[model samples]
Target: MSKTAELLKGAAEGFPDEVVTQATVRHLDLPGGAGRFALITLDNGFDHTKPTTFGPQSLTNLDAAIDQVAAEAEAGEIVGVGLTGKPFIFAVGADLKGVEVLKRREDALTIGIGGHEVFKRLSALPVPTFAYYNGAAMGGGVEVGLHCTYRTVSRSIAAFALPEVFLGLVPGWGGCTLLPNLIGADRAVTVIIENALNQNRMLSGPKVYELGIADAIFEAADFLEQSLVWTSAVLRGEIEVVRQDPDRGEAWDQAVARGRAIADEKVHGAAPAAYRALDIISQVRNGDLREGFAAEDQALADLIMGDELRSGLYAFNLVQRRAKRPVGAPDKSLARKVSKVGIVGAGLMASQLALLFVRRLEVPVVLTDIDQERVDKGVGWVHEQIDMQLLKGRINQDKANRLKAAVTGSLDKAEAFSDADFVIEAVFEEMGVKQQVFAELEAVVPEHAILATNTSSLSVTEMASKLKHPERVVGFHFFNPVAVLPLLEIVRAEQTDDASLATAFSVAKSLKKSAVLVKDAPAFVVNRILTRFMGAVLGAIDEGTPVEVADRALAPLGLPMSPVVLLDLVGPAVAHHVAGTLHKAFPDRFGTSENLGRVVEAGKRTLYVYDSGTPELDPEVAALFKVGDTVLTEEQVRARALEAIAEEIGLMLDEGVVAEAQDIDLCLITGAGWPFHLGGITPYLDREGISERVVGRRFLPVGTAGVPE
Candidate 1:
C-alpha cells in the first residue's frame, strides 16, 4: 500500500465511524459511439440532512475508487469517468469533527497531505473526466469539480461557495491553486474572499453556470441522464466545451488589492486565512501548479495547529450545539399551541412583529392601535413586505397571497385579543405603558393566552406585575431589522410559568432563530453587556477624547461594527434610552453619559456623518460636548472599555444571569455579532490578561483559547 494510504488507514482505525462517506463505482454505457464509462457516486448512507464530508477513511475510499477507474481505462473497458453525488447533496467539504480531534503535528500534516494526494489523482487520470454537481458543494467539494475536465450542474442545486476563510482556514486541498487559474483572478477573489466574508453567500446552479464554472445545466429530475449524454458527445468530438482564458494582467493585481482591502476592512486583519488566501491567488499568476499545491499543504498544516483555528472551532461547535439546545428551556410538551397571535400596537415595531408571526407561524395575526388610520397603516405595511418578498422570488404568488390575507388590524383591543393564544406588545419602552397594555390585554385575552413584551431593556417583572395573570407574561425581545438578525432572547420573569416559557421557545424555534434563555434582569443579557461596553466609550468622550478617536479605538477588538456605526444603525435615541435604563438598574457599576444625552437632545442622528464616503465628525453633534484637557490615547481608551466589560461580565456571572460562561459567549456571538476568532468576550479577556487585571482571575481556564503552554 502507498504511504498516504497507510497513514489514512491508521488514522481511520482510531475513529472508525468518523469518516461518513463511501465511494461506489458502477459501469454505464454511453451514447455517440463511446463504449462505456465508470461512474462514482459519493454518499454518506444517510438522508440529505447529513451531507457528505471527507475524512481519512472517506478520502481513502475515494482514492481506491479512482484507482479502479484508472485501471479500467487502461484495460480499454471505459472511454471516460464521471463523478456525481447522491440525491439532493453533493458534499459540504472536509469533516470538521475529524480535524477537531487532531492534536499532533504529524496527524495534521498527514491529513492535509493525504487529501491533496488523493484529490490530485483526478487530474492525473489518463481519460476524459466530468463532475455532475447535483446539489450543494462547498470548500473541498467545489475543489474536486475543478480537477475535472468539464462540469454539469443541476437546476435544483443551490448553496455553492468556497467558505474556508470564514472558518479560519484557507482552501488547502488544491483549491487555492486551481480556482484562480481556471476562473480569472478577479472572479476568483470574489468567490474565495468577498462572498466568504459576507456570511458565506452562495450561488444557485444557474448562477454557477453564468459564472463560467459549469459547462451545462439540467433539471434535477434528469440531471444525471443529461450529464451522461453530454459527456458522451464530448468524448466523440460531437460537442465542444469552451472556457475563458484567465486574465493575468493588471486586472489580476487590482483584484488582489481589492480583496486585501475587503479583508482588512471586514476582519481588521485579525483573520490570517484571508491574507494567506490572497497570497496563494497572487502567486498563481506566476507560479506552477506543483509549487502552489505545496504552499497550500504548508499553510493548511500551520493553520490547523494555530490558536485562531482552535478558537473558531470552539465558537462553531457552540453555535451548532448550544444554540439549538437552549440552556434552561422547559420540556417541548409543555408548550401551548399558538393558533392566533395579537400585537398591542400598530406602529413600525408592531408591524414588523405582525409580518414575522404571519410568515413563520402561518396563522392569523391581528394588530391593534388607538385609531383607524394607524391600524390601517400597520396592516398596509405588512402587505407591502409580503409583496416585496414575492417580487424578490423569496415567496411564490400563492404564499404571498396567503400571508397577506392572514394579517389584520383593529382599533379595538378586545376584538384583537379575543381569540389570540399568544399576544405580544411592542409599544413604547416605558414600564407604565407596557403595564397598561398588558393590563388591557389581560382583561380581553383568554386565560391560557400568552402575554409577551418586545422590550429591549425594561424589566419584564414590572411589566407583568399589573396583569391579573402575571404567570403568562414573558419577555420576547428581538433585535431591530427583525428579518435579518437570527437571535431571539427569551426572558423568563419571576412569575413566568413553565408553559409560557416553553411556548416562547417553541415559537422562536418555529421562526428558525437561535434562542437564548435569559433572566428577568434589566436589559436582559445582550443589552446589559452592550450598554456597559458603550458606556465606557461614551465616558471616554465625556472625558475629552475625540469623538472619532474613541470610535476607532475598538477596531482592534474586531467587533462586527464600530461602536459609532452601531449607535447610528440603532438610532441615538434608542441607545440613550437603553443606557439610561441600565444606569438606573446598576447605578454603582453602570453610568449614563451627559454627552450622549446632549447629542440626543440636539436631534442629531449620527455623531459622525459621511462626506464623500469619508466619515467626518458632524460639527453640530461635536459641539454638543464640552472638551477638557483630560484626553486619552487609543490604547487607554481600549483598556478602559475592556476593564468595564470585564467588571460587568463578572457581576453577571455572580448573579447567575445565565447558566454558564458558555451561555454568555453564545449570546454575544449570536446576538451581538462578536467575532468568532475571539471566542466571545470572556475568551478574549482571558487571552488579553484583562480578566485577571480587572477581576483578579481569568474568566476561563488556561489553554481554553488554545494558548500554548
Candidate 2:
C-alpha cells in the first residue's frame, strides 16, 4: 500500500474515541444546464452544538469520497466538484483527543502527511473544486477550503478562523502555506498570527469575504442554493473568477517581520508555534507548495511531541470543559429565575452590569443611585452602547430599542427594586458603604431576591454581616471590561445559601461567563494571586531595581502584559488598595510597596507614557519613587515573583479559597488573562520546578500539563 494508507492503518490501531466526520456525496444537477456536479457534505451525525472535526477515520472517509469524485471528474461524469457542511458548521479542525494519544513523533507526522495527501487532492482534481462555508470553520476546516479552486461563505457564520497558533501549534495541514498564496501575506499574518494571539479572535463572515478568503458571500437561509448556482456560473464560463497575485518581494518580508513583532509582544518568544508558523509563511514567498507542505509536516511533528502543545491542550480542555461545569456548584434545579435585576450604584461598573443583564437575560434592569443625574448618566451609557452594537450589526434597530428600554434609571430604591429578583451593588469598595447599600436594598427587594457584591478584594461575608438576609448574599465579582472578559468569580459567603449561589451561577450562565465557585476569603482567587504577584515585583522595585528591568523580568513567563502595564490597566489606586488588603491579611507574604502608595497618592494612573506608541517611564511618576541602595537582576526578580505566586497558590489551596488548583488556574486564565501555554500558572510552575521548590509539591501531576513519561 501507499505511505498515506500505511499511516492510516497505524492510526487506527490505537485511535482514541473520535466523532468521525463522514464525507457523503450526492450528484447535483448544475443550474443553467452547466452539467452534473458532485457535492460532498461533511457531517458528524450531530446537531450544530457539536461541530464536526476530522480524525484519522474521518480523513480516510474524505479520501475515499475524493476518489469517487476524482473518478467522476476524469470520466467527464461531473462538470465540477463541491464541498459543504451540515447545518451551522463546516469543521473545527483536528480532533485534539487524537493528537493527545500520539505516542511517537512518527505518529504525529502521520497526522500531518495524511491530511495533506487527502486535502491536496481537491486542487489536483481534473475538474475545479468549490467550497461552501455554510457556518463556523476553524483551523483545518478553513485550510481544507484553501485547497479548493473557489470558495463561498454565508454572511451569518459567526466564527471563521485559523486558531492553531493560539493553541501552541502551527496550522500544519495547509493553512500557513495556502492562505498567504490565496490572500496577501499581510492579511494572512492578521488571521494566522495577530488574531490568534489576540485571545484567538475570530473573523465574522463579512470579514472573511473582505479579506478575499471567500469568492462569493450568500445569506445563510439559502447559502447552499446560491453557492451551487455560483459554482455553475463559474464552470459554464459565464462568470470570470479573478484573483490578484500575492506580493513576494519587500511587502512579503515586511509582513513576516510584522508577524514576528506581534508574536514577540504576545508570547515574548516563550512559545515556538507562532515563530514556526511565521517561518513557514516566510518561505512560501519562494512559491514552492511542496516545500511549504514539508515544512508544515516537520513543524507539526516537532510541536506535537513538545510540552507547550501539551500544556495548550490541557488549558484548552480546562476552558472548554471544566469551565462549563464549575466545581462544587449547586444543582441547576435549585436556581431561582431572575426575572428583574437591580443595580445599587449607577457608575461605570454598574452601567456595564446593567447593559449585560438587559442584553443577555432580556430582563428589565433598574439602576438606582443617590441622585437622578448619576442614574440618568448610567442609563444613557447603556443606551449608547446598544446603539453602537446596532451600528456594528450585532443587533438590529428593534433589538437596540428593546435593550435601551429594558435598562432604566431611578432615584427611588424602593420603587426600583421592589420586584427585582437579583440586586447587585457596584458602590464604593469600602465595607461600610457596601453594607449600607445591601441593608437599604434588603428592605426594598423581595426576601427571596439574591444580593451580589462586585467586590474585588473586600470580604463578602463582612459586607453582609449586619444584614438580616445575609444568607441571600453572594459575591458576583466580574473583571473589568465586563463584556469582554469571560471569568466570573462566584463567591459564597459564610451565610450564603445554596439557592443564592445557584441563582448567581444561573445568572452567570445566561451572561455567557465561566463562573468559578470561590470561598469568601480576602481578595478571593485571581485577585489574591495577582496581588501577591504584583507585590513581589513592586517589592523588587522598592529595593532599587529599575522599573523597566522589574517589568521585563516576567517577559520569559509570557504573561499577557507586563506587571507595569497591568498596573496601568488595574489603576495604581486600585492595585494599592488590593495590596493593602492582602498585606493586612498576610503580612509577611504580601508587602505593600511605599513607592506604589506614593504613586497612588500622586494620583498617577500609569508609570509610563505612550506618546510615541511605545511606553517610556513618565518623568513625574519616576520622581515619586524612593529606591534603596540594593538592586537585583531580571532573573532574580522573576524568581522572587514566581516564588511568591507559587506560595500564595499553595496557601490558597490550604485555606480552601478555591476547591482545587485547577480552579485557581481557571480564574487566572479567564479572569486575569493569563497565557494558555502556562496552563493558568500552576502547570508552568510545575514544569519549571518552581511549584516544588517553593510550595514543596507540584500543583499538577506529571503528564497532566507536560509531556508524558
Each prediction's TM-score against the native?
0.96, 0.98
Model 1: what TM-score?
A: 0.96
What's model 1's overall lDDT?
Answer: 0.86
lDDT string, candidate 1, 1-709, tens digits? 7776897887665343674789999998897668889999999898777879999888989999998999998898888888899888888888887776566666777777888888888888889889999988998889888888888999888789988887778888877899888878888888889998776779899888888888999999999999998888899888998787888899889999999998988889777888898998998887488888888888888887776776777777778898999999999999999999999899998899899999999999999998999999999999999999999998999999999999999888897789999999988889888888888889999999999999999989988887778999999998877877778899999999999999999999998888999888988888888888888888888888887888888888767888888888888899999998987888887887887888899888887789869777788887788867778888889998889999988888888888878888888887877877777788888888898999889878876656334
**What CA RMSD would you report for each candidate?**
1.9, 1.4
Whole-model Cα lDDT of every candidate shown, in order: 0.86, 0.91
Off by over 4 Å in 1: 7-17, 701-709
Worst ten in a row by lDDT for model 1: 11-20
RMSD of 2: 1.4
Clashing pairs in 2: none
In candidate 2, what are the lDDT values of residues 161-231, reduced to their tens digit? 99999989999999999999999899999999999999899999999999999999999999999999889
Give the per-residue Cα lDDT of candidate 2 at 347: 95
**Deviation of model 1 at 463, angstroms:** 0.7
Which lDDT value does model 1 have at 644? 92
